[model samples]
Target: MLLASIIMHAAQPIRKERSAASIYHLLQGKRSAQTLQDAHMYGLTHLFGIYPKLSRQLFDQVAASVMNEAERYENQDIPYFEGMTYQTQTESFLYRLLLLIQLLSNHVREEKRYIPVTDNPAVKHWIKQWYRQEQHRLDDWRNAIYKELYDLLGKLPPLQAALFVDRLTGYQHIGLTPGQLAGKYNIHETDVLLYQTSTVHHLLHHAENKAAIFPYLAALTNQPVHKTRTITSTAQKTRTMLERGLTLDQIAAVRGLTENTIKDHIVEMAWLDGEELSRRFLSDTDASIILECAAGAGTKKLKQIHALLDGKYNYFQIRLALALRRGHGVEA
Candidate 1:
């Protein structure tokens, strides 16, 4: 799964990748509506990630209301998003759900209040012309995607191809629900869903492997490609300190932080860099020892690992090894 996840690499859109503070300012410092939308959005891109099935008792009428409002305003300008154009029918639906959830959450959190976004005018005169232009280009985009899919299916074994073909129908390539496809194939529902997801992961990467699909993928996830997960401010500083050849204690003192804190940061840096977690911070021998200990423990719990190693490796060294083994919190 991890290998498949990183086969394609692309920079996420500036809009999707903007910091939380930037999002607040973008919406003109509103009641965290954009931030809230971002929270739900993490699920959109990881279509194959593990999430608990929503229980019937937890279903909200707000979702139904949002979907209703979305259908009502389809192809019309939405006041809630303040006329953001990247928003298409699907995006508006999700955004509407976020908006209603925000209202309901705020009402529950503090006092009665509603935050509404002002609507801007649609690009009226040029709207149809622009849409027609997009409609024309849409064919080129579809052709590119289909070409890649065809090539991928061509390379796949027959069983996999057959499993995948069942998902598409007619000239339009409409998608079938997993339950429908599962029944057709006489396979477990889970197996059908998993197989479809595996093929999709392959094709998505094939389509996106060459370049970052900005608004195209952004329109789907509403979240960035998440550059920060692999590198951070403290990690950056740690690298610079190591470059200066300053020892951990010396760097910690200079930076006005505890040596332990500095060590933790160094380990985090290692985690970010994977097997390349620089020899300067963690020697090859020390890292190997930590890795061996962790594998034996079969868990990443700091104390359990610390105990298993029996003082051979410190907490920080153990952590760095764990990070490297776990692919260092990176998708690519």
Candidate 2:
């Protein structure tokens, strides 16, 4: 059953690679600018998924460059568009950078080639030959480019830098881009992004330590502690009420206790006899009145009973003694 459910839910979204030719076609005409810009933003969001923190750093660098450009173009005489220029330019530059990064990241994410590394002679010989021929420099090259982009973005204001990074890195948690997550999850894009970001943070922190991971996993899986505590507290309350003068029927009426269980507790505590305690307590006017008064009796009555019982007698003995003193027959 579990395997079937897992298989049924294992579906991942099919992502079509955006080819350079297709992008070039879109960029050819006047109406193509907006289409290209949208495509770039989509790619940037995906790039963040591949390397969240790194992508964010690069985004900030692009934003800083745009801000510097905006500052140069600013007209102090015309205040209306001066302040808005930086934001507009920065957004445009960020979108373009995101597209380029996405293209590179997607290629890496889809790559299937792998060469095993082992201590065996044949594998070691193969690796040495491959390295000497420089057959797989893509990893090193990609890392260098990513680092360069990040180094450039490190100049923006802390808040702007953080926001730029989050925009890209935040989609990985939900395994979807902000737009796709929002549409599929039936929530706002921002909400899906934030949740994904939070999940990443939690997973990162917990991954470092087994103790931390266990507690987090337990919480997610609904651990038994919370349920156990609730049940124990409820039982304690029920025991306390039974010890106080609340008859089983009255306790049941007030606390939603069942009649059979209440009788069992009364018998267990030796407050009433094993057989027909409910009938006797209910049918006898004097016993019923005493039980009712007991329900409202102070802790002093409990203390008195406790003192009378001491070690020589239990609660049952004290109750029998009290009944005899009051001229009430036990047989009744």
Candidate 3:
């Protein structure tokens, strides 16, 4: 139900402009310009990249059921997700927490031999470093971690908290796999993943925002929350050329890409850096006209906006204008 609600929420805004596959790509973290533009254009940025490992088969099944019962999944308040900001951090944070819990649990029981929960060399290496620094104070570290988790998990829904706790491989207890969790809760396997994701995101948000209150948990975060979204590497190159006063056509020629591809890069940069770069492509007056036309038409379709304007502005101008409408100003 949670995954369905998320899909339905994302689908409602872009139903007229894009297909269901677009949303799948966004959730899978495609990192393509089209998916990135779709996220910002449809106000689905918060849901972007939330499920990178999502299967196409599962998504199709859920999306099909959701479209038939679309009205049932509206108005869901998904406050726990900040996928665009935390996409790189969520899984790493969870892995660290799980490993730490297992290590602490086994250490307290004086258990000398046990298999690690994860075979990730990086995670194991990081834990080894962390353990060495705090080995002499394992009891204090254990108590602190318990308190931090207790406080953080207390803020989540009961079911979500259980989903998180049940995944921890501690002491003699082995963590339940997602399939096992699905069967135990009588829900779809996807729901198990979503519930756990929501829980972790919630923990991350609190740890970052309420750091003073969650010192130990906050310290576990490997990266800071992003203040602005990032554009693709290819887009960054285009930005470098644009910054050097190169026209789009010239940049396209120089970079061996079509003019259309360069424009896509500009649009992506507009999504991330806002009006600072997009304004160079279109005048403020024209942008204002496009914004007004879009608002009047109640649509973000560039074709509709262009027709409404009697084709006075080109498609690129219309697109640039719309991208700038919700843009952030030059940051200090």
Candidate 4:
């Protein structure tokens, strides 16, 4: 129900304007220019890439069931989901925390051997390095971690906190799997996953913002913990070319892509880099006209805006302008 609710909430803003698959792609964190653009345009950036492994069959089923009752799933205050900003580091951060907890649990019992919670080599390597560094001060490390987690989890809702705590593999207590958690809580496995994700995201937010309070916890993540938004790699390449003063046609030829593809990259960059690049494809006056048309027509639909302008601006131009408008947070 929580996963469905989140999907339904994301669908509402772009209902009927975009296909169901678009929402699926958005949740899956497709790196396409279109998906990224849709996220910014529809104000779904926070939810973007929240569930990268969502199965298509499940999404279609949930999407079909909730299409008519989207309003019923409206969440006035959805839990913290800065997927766009935090997706890259969330899993690694969680892995480090879990592995650290498991290590601490066993170390306290003077146990040298225990199956690890995560098989990821990178996580294991990081944990090993950290343990070696703090070996002599293991007790202090453990106490600090406990204090940090106690204060941090206290800030979360009870259920979310439980989900986080239940996933930890302590000395004698094996952590619960998502399936086990689902059965225990009587919610769908997917909801359990999402709840766990929400809990981790909340903790990550606190760690990044309140570094003083969560020093050890914050130090667990090896990945950059800043909240910087990013663009797709392909679009990033296009941005590099643009910086070199290459025209759209020249870029297409050099990159072996169509001019239209190049234009798409440009628009994607506009969404991230703002009017600085969008104005290259669309002029200020033309963009103003497009924004006015969008405001007057009460839509960001490119065709409608193009038609409103009597086909004076091509779809690409109108799209570029709308990207700027959305980037600038222009009213309407």
Candidate 5:
């Protein structure tokens, strides 16, 4: 039987489920007058899916939408007034249209939909509270993702860090496209795409559970204590070097890497360790100034933070202060 038949046979209310196709599909596209019908059958969404759970509802929605489109096209295709001068889509054209509908349905499967809500006081308060929690959760996942991608980039030979930063920051901050990045960085377009793909692959390789983040970190963090120490020794060494009063420049020289690389090691470590180390190296006076500057700048980049402070703090002090705040778990 068609999977759609099975769903009808079971006659169960379906919600979210687990499957490979997108749950976001039905939320998109032109639903027309078919939406209500689509919402009921559910199987239409999963014509090609395994709707074992929450995803079953998602698949059903898709199946309904696809079938509706097919029905609409078929009903409108030809008229029955024998000699009337009317035109209709060709059979092949209709056939191809249905194919396009199925293909396009999956186009936005990877994206997430926004919650449908309004500003009722209780609803708003609930949403705000929920957002605070989700923001923290998403932030954690984003951080882990950034770390894993960066760790892979860090392993690359000379200029890897610069390349990663330039590509990502420039694209995100400066709005540079892949083609533009190629021109700006003196590299090939293919290399840019390949690098992006490799980074994503690396991220997926360290899969926590699936999607962009949620499950992956969830799974990883579930591991034992020893497994949680995923950070590299370079960060630990940088911490020791800093504690021993080796300046960034000195540490860079000793490690045979750039000053920026050393700084990255420190900042990332600070983020990982949280505020535990902040009180040790940060004086209350400098801490206040750093936090103030961080609030004004709203960023952690050394150059950006220094500029925001109008040059009162030196490079090493700024690096430490920023790391201190980051370690202290104060995002601002």
Candidate 6:
């Protein structure tokens, strides 16, 4: 029985080709003689099933107007044939309008519309009130679609459904190409595209169920805590060496790496050597004094000693003269 119903539904083709002249010709004779009930039934059976319910509402509303105009054409109160022609024209306009609406809905679903929070009180208040009213309906729709899709494809290997939602919504939010998102997540681009299509249907049905989707999305995209900690430690070390008057080359040599590599590290650490030192070590008077002391000691024996005291003494406290004149103390 289900199979038969599916076949019957599939057999009903959605009429896509449309033109004003074509619509006028189709409705010319029917308007003057057709009953509203007959028109409604014909339109519902022919068009309504192919589209979503919201679209059907628009179609029915326009159809109702056509029915009223047709009644006027039947009365012959306005020039009989001209009234019939005008009714045909109106129906044609309505048909095109409905087609345009469907195109827009598809575009919106594909593009993933995001409404921003507005500062205007009226807009904010209205959205809040509207959400309160529709929240339950949205939850119900989300649950239904999630269950339906799970039932259909759940037998496949357990791919993270939350991750799929994240990729879909991220694409919508960030306008990333499927290929880009796939690369970021280490998945196939085709999989991302497929998930995007499935998500569109789910979003349309459960427009209000965005809450659960975002939490999962955050988890999928969130930076790993350990990675963040490692980066932070590297940054702290870079800044300390930089403040201690270590040139990029010197730091690189000390770390036994290339100068460019050390510069890259500093860049990632958000440090700007000699140009804009980070605020992290900006207030450390000890660091500032040490850097000054070592500034001119780059080639002398004192330079080697200063390097030894790298993190220990401030520049002013290093006593350069005392060290240099150690064996010639009374020769002043």
Question: Number of the top candidate by TM-score?
Answer: 4
- Candidate 2 stretches with Cα past 4 Å from truth are 1-91, 111-141, 169-332
Model 1 pairs in collision:
none
lDDT of 2 by residue, 88-142 (tens): 1222223333433343355467633332212345434533453465435646545
Q: List where candidate 5 sits over 4 angstroms from the true fold.
A: 1-227, 240-250, 275-282, 297-304, 325-332
Q: Over the stretch 1-332, how does candidate 1's per-residue lDDT look in tens digits?
A: 21111111101212224443322222221213232222222211232121113222322332233334544333332111111112122223223322323333343355444433213223222223434555446445444435544667776656556777665532323445668877777765655544544554444443334435322322223233422343336657867988888888898888898888777666655544656654655687887777676566444456876887788777766666655654322121
TM-scores for all candidates? 0.41, 0.19, 0.93, 0.94, 0.28, 0.20
Taking the tens digit of each residue's C-alpha lDDT, what string does model 6 give over 1-332? Answer: 11122122222221222222222222222211111111221221121111111233433444445445543333231101112112212222222222222223334356435433224454445434644664455445344444544543343234434334343222134334557767767876544543433333232222223535433222112123212321334456656888798987788888787765564455334311222443332334544444344444432133454676673753323332222221121111
**lDDT winner, 3 or 6:** 3
Query: Which has the better TM-score: candidate 3, or candidate 5?
Result: 3
Per-residue lDDT of candidate 5, residues 1-332 (tens digit): 12333333222222232222333222221122122122222333211111212244645664575455544333231111100000011111212222222222222243233322232454445434544655445545445545654565565544323444554321113334668867877775544543443333333334433435434333322233323422346767888898898987899999998987776565455444645655555576886897677667555455776777788776656655655542232343
List where candidate 3 sits over 4 angstroms from the true fold: 75-79, 225-228, 327-332
lDDT per residue (tens digit) for residues 81-100 in model 4: 88887788878889999989
For model 2, what is the alpha-carbon lDDT of residue 193? 35
Worst 10 residues of 5 by lDDT: 78-87
lDDT of 3 by residue, 172-274 (tens): 9999999998888788888888778778888888888988888777777875445445678898899899989999789999999999999999888887777
Q: What order do candidates take by TM-score, descending?
A: 4, 3, 1, 5, 6, 2
For each candidate, what is the lDDT? 0.44, 0.34, 0.83, 0.83, 0.42, 0.35
Q: Could you tell me the lDDT of residue 66 within candidate 1? A: 34
Clashing pairs in 4: none
